[model samples]
Target: VEAPNQTIAIEQSQSDRSKKTFHPVKVDLPGDQITKVTLGRLHFSETTANNMRKKGKPNPDQRYFMLVVGLYAVSQDQFYLLSANVSEKIIVRASNPGQFENDSDVLWQRGHVPETIVYHGRVGINTDAPDEALVVCGNAKVMGRVMHPSDSRAKQNIREVDTNEQLRRITQMRLVEYDYKPEFASVMGIKNTHETGIIAQEVKEFLPQAVREVGDVACNDGEKIENFLMVDKDQIFMENVGAVKQLCKLTNNLEVRIEELEQWNRKLARLKRMSSLKSTVSEESKVSRCSRATSLLPSKKSVPLKSNKVKLCSVKIFRVTIIALIAIMALCALTISTLCLLSVHDRHFEKHPIYRQVVELVTSSSVALSPSTTTAALQGESTISQSTQPVSRIPEVNFCDILPCDKVYCCPIHLQKVKFLNYEKTNAKEKRSRCHCINCNFIMLLSKISEIIKKKTLFLIFLGIDTTISSIQILETQQSIDSRYCSKNLQCRSGNYTYVIPINKYTPMDVEISLEINTTEPLIIFLCKVTFGNYCSPYSSSQNSRKDFLETTQGRQHIWTLPVAKLYDSAYYFRVAVPGFASCSTDPYFAGIFFTDHYFYFYRQCN
Candidate 1:
């Protein structure tokens, strides 16, 4: 068969296995006008077909025939095969000269040619249908990197990622080491080795963009084709980058805060040193003042005779004047008493003869002694000698005269409950007899001074400095009392102690309790949340009881974090107890409990 623009060559081999040559067969058919052809008598003999079938070879004896069709173009040095079937068209061409030796090599040459091959539609390998531009159904080995399109112009709606949220989500993700099932592993050509990765389901919960649904090719367990959730590791890696950036920012902030705290600690140390030095100086000054006051007191040998005589004369004059004043007070009191009696019993005394006789006798005695008494008083005055030095008299002052008697002195409205006394001012001069008002200004000043002093003293005590003059027993007793009354609902006692922290409705539900404890021995800590006004007991049936043991040495510090699922208007109690037969009464333990929100902002203490 032949055509005007194409040539067809037909060859047939004899039934001998050793024969390598073929004989040409010619058919008288027009190829240009006829689009189809049928050859009914072109078949092998019975013996040849039987031999080929028994050997499982189509042409073991070279008895089969071959058909070679070729199309040649004048402008190109290549051979092409074209197929147009069911509205689909395909064109395969071989341009390599070495492929002409074997006709089968020409079909394989299409893939190996050193030229760019472009596909207008999807291309699939080992797959009947592909849903992507290029898909490989089985494992593929690449010697080089495969890059995806990452040009800025190809992307839209690009924005920055929220690194904080990324960090939070990343923290919530659970990492797992898993091995693929045997059937799936064999189908996917994957080795049964432990692999570390995040679960696609869990990743989807936190970051949906990192997970997607993909058709599983290893679904051979009597199940239909199923879509499996697959995780995009690249997306996870990008999210990890953002999370690391956020972590770096947090680390930097923490470093800054630590530095600031260290600075404050240094300042506190310096202030404490200064305060200690001031206390020492004040003690030395007090000793010196006492010594100077003792030295200023005059001794018996140091006083002069003239001064002694003057003191004696002054004493004598003071005694005589006191005696005279006493006599005058007595006479005046008697006269006043007589007048009061006479006025009350005027009628009764007038009718009584004895009362009249007594009154007349008292009047006659007074009349008889008036001249003698005057002469005696003059004689007494003449006998007393006056001191040469005129003494400066001290004016007497009344209690109400010095104070604000007209109006009450009170603190400000805000501080009216605070009590203050003006005990420093004992006396006031008569010339300056005015009401002295202790106003709010003076009270506020005093309060501020007291506060400052109290703060300084507490600071000193906290630093283990014994600034007070109290005895050790006194200090210990005071400390025990303070510990007993440290909190309203909880009291520190021997053996074990329970501290309750009230979580009001205003507190955030999602918060954490952080404990920083310094202990001298091993301690057991119990934490739980209960209804309001309830205590957390060891044997109680409370929910969410977080119990932990703190194994520590002398002065060893430990930090713990407990995530609190607080209910509204609940009370959370964390108890600290000694392990086994130990007790906390013999030794003091320090604990700082901090309540923080989800973001770790401290707002309250475990008071």
Candidate 2:
């Protein structure tokens, strides 16, 4: 906060006024005071404490402290004391700031700080450029310095990674670009031998349990880096990717074939049950056999001459044997599968993000604890092996459109609990809107934001404003999940893992500007996305007029170009239209505001 000044009779300070200010006086500078500082200003909250209370301790009584950091253009040696009324010392600093080649002009707002320190100074640098490392701590004596990284104090020089094992792996790589791919190589390369020695000492506690887990799974360390630096469309990279996809597909097909074979076994089982020997016995067969003994035709009178004994013909067992053979084959397949999955978990395979996510979901489902309260994410495991499980689709999420701004032309539909309502008339004058959280059961916060454009529109009353925005790109993904069927084989998801959007060609940029959408039971959604930058428009804004938009339609992507003239600041921002009743978020519908060029800005705004 700012220190007290003579705004009571404000005037240009005389040199003597500054000269007379060499007093270490005390002043009660209110913490709530708003000051015109070099940085963008924000108020300090009175309710929050400077320090957190211990686990069970009661909050301390409220007390306030006064502090200020200000600058003046007097002499470089100028100093400022606390105001003549308070007991706190004031900090004043002015410097001809040093320049860094990579320095950005952006100023960021600071928030809460947890760490406490007495006082320390540190500086590290490289000839290349200075890093913008911002660290804020609270309630501590602070001091800082800047230095370069190229210093070769013998102890400060950078070193290369040269572990003997790493070297051997390096030899194995036929790298087109001759680079190492070990996960630790880069981390170790910049460190000197001393650092390597330290790391090696802790190998048992920190290093990988398996080589596959340690290096890039498909290749050794040096080879990993070599392939990493190789040219695009490199034969090795293509083969590797092809191999992975083929493996995944192959596993899925194997599951399906197992299920089909099992079904066939069931059919054979039914045939054997119906073809039982007892059931197949016929009266005619018995009669013919009795009469076949030629003399047996006179059996009624020939009893006295009966030979030893009449042996009953044995019934042949045919179908039961066939059924048993089929069952045994099924059992053998099952046993082989169990053994395969019993193998170790490989880093190359299990380390995949999607695979991990799947495993997490499955573990949560199979456990006693409910998923809602669990924050379980699979982390750091060291081994290389494979396990197969059927992938299942998660439950769908419901989505709805957000309410338009409080304008005369807005459709005025706000989500209520499972319903939509129009409060445009009753709450027309209110600044903050109170709407139903929509069908999605979350608050739809509303506030008015200012949008002032200077250009005049062709229609005297209308200024040229296009409120178009990109539609939320939706996708449907089907995955096989039933354990009973999946347990039989991994190939069960033959055509089940199809993408909703059958992309003609997947581009790097296309994949980057993407997000999964919302879905319930039937419809699945994915957002066409851009990162938090200047390339896209905002889907929702607190400050912008919606009435400026001309054409409002459905089933198409809307774009608007915000030209240089339309921009109010170098970091100008625009909002995307929040579709009515579309349980939507700024993230899914908004590409965000990134300025690649004046032309790209126009592309989004143009008709």
Candidate 3:
């Protein structure tokens, strides 16, 4: 009969008793399609049945089960099903599972649908046996950051890196560009594109900490594991940082050293400039002295002597008597002049207290004459000469005529060795006369003063005067004395053979020749006045040139104020030659000529 709403009916059904079966009662529902049957007294509640009926469609929060045969128990308001077993496997499959179905092995599956998976044990993806908590055999694309433990507590034996060592090792590492192999690319799921990185093998040689060996698990089979080298990019980056720091320190040190060298170069330039100025001043002074000496000599054409002749031949006896009387008066006058000059020379040297003091100072210390002593000596000698002879007669004495033309005469007080540039040509009588001349003595004093100035440069500095400042003051002082004073310097290099430098017509006639030589060998310097041609040799006779020999035992700088005669011609030449059998040095020696424009002759005779 059909079941409609909820009406139920019970009827007794007859069964055959021939097979030992008995008749059973049957209950049937007529209205509702749901059927409920119970073997013993029914204990099912209406509320629990109604709840099960409401959940009949589908609910993820609750579990639903269909059993063919099971024991059910109801205690208080709870419903429980006692022991149930399935005949085969049990699987819960998705509604539209694709390529996967319920099987004896898989317990659950969600197919292509995205869902959350939570597991307490290890999980391996694309790998059958995972060695870690989570293992991915191929490349993984992560949308979030992948973090590793980096706390200080996790590390041990931390220390600072040596930047210098790191820099050296980094220089040794070789960087390379290469493409991944097909097999490697396929296993790693990466494209076979060119990549830039340091070679792991090369880096291991210098910086092993930056390199490591890693297994190529994707390419390896289960039987054997294959390994390859890998370089850690982070380690290289750290090394580069340390290297940069070391380079900065080295650059700073180089900058400081460069600055120090620049300062020294500037100082040397200043000193060179000062030396040039001093040489110029000295040359000018020499030129002036020669010019004054030339001007002081009286020209033979300027003054003419007139003679008157008497007719004494007509009366020989009368003329003879008058001539005898004149001759006798002339002899008496000559004897008186001789005695006066001899007494003056002795009195000047012996009686003067200042002269005595100067003699003592020179003999004791061997120091050259000072400027003050030179001035006093000149003034005292001029006074004595004026007292003994008339002013007009003093000028006629011809001071330059008596001076030794071949030698530099120094004062006899110190008795220093006399250096003769040429053979002496003056007679003994002339030498005696020169010693007696006031002008000759003054010239000797001036020469000594020039020597003192040259050798006592350090002494001037010790007295709180720098050489440059003292030189400038001397220039100013001399300029005040004579405005015509000027100077020039001629520089050249000398070798084993002779080197010549020409002096132009514009050069001063009284120019002083100061030679400075830098060499290790002996050298001879000559000042020659060309008489006829443009050429003048250092080996020329004393009539044309004056020469001085300089011998040196060591490599040193030598300066000499050459004792040259007064320049008679408008043009001259300077000749330098290395003396002796020594070969020329690889390096050329330096030679410089300083021409000073000042009247040294007039300064001695007048001042």
Question: Cα RMSD (Å) per model?
Answer: 31.6, 33.7, 33.7
How does model 1 fare in lDDT? 0.40
Q: Assess every candidate by TM-score.
A: 0.32, 0.17, 0.29
Question: Mind giving the per-residue lDDT tens digits that candidate 2 earns over 495-606?
Answer: 1111111111111111112122221111112221111112212422222333433332222232332221111111112222323312223332112111000001000111
In candidate 3, stretches whose alpha carbon ends up further than 4 angstroms from where it belongs are: 1-156, 217-225, 279-607
Candidate 2 residue-wise lDDT at 509 = 16
lDDT of 2 at 554: 29
What is the TM-score of candidate 1? 0.32
The Cα error of candidate 2 at residue 101, in Å, is 40
lDDT tens per residue, model 1, 470-520: 111111112111222122212222322332222221223333444454443
Per-residue lDDT over 1-607 for candidate 3, one digit per residue giving the tens place of the 0 to 100 score:
0112332122222243122222232446569587786543211111111112244542223221111244456678675786554322112232121312223222333334588443445667776666558867566789999676789999999998789997898788777899976655555556645788777778888888777765545553333335667678888888999999999989998886677557546656676677888889867855665455446555444323111111222244366569878997676566556546654754444443333432333223234233233323322333322332222222211223323334222112232232212222335885576555545544554564465476543232222211010011112112121112110111111111111122222222233444444432223333322222211223322334323433332212334443222321112232333332112231111122111111121112122
What does candidate 3 score on TM? 0.29
Ranking of predictions according to TM-score: 1, 3, 2
Of the two candidates 1 and 2, the one with more favorable TM-score, higher being better, is: 1
**Predicted model with the maximum TM-score:** 1
Measure candidate 2: CA RMSD: 33.7
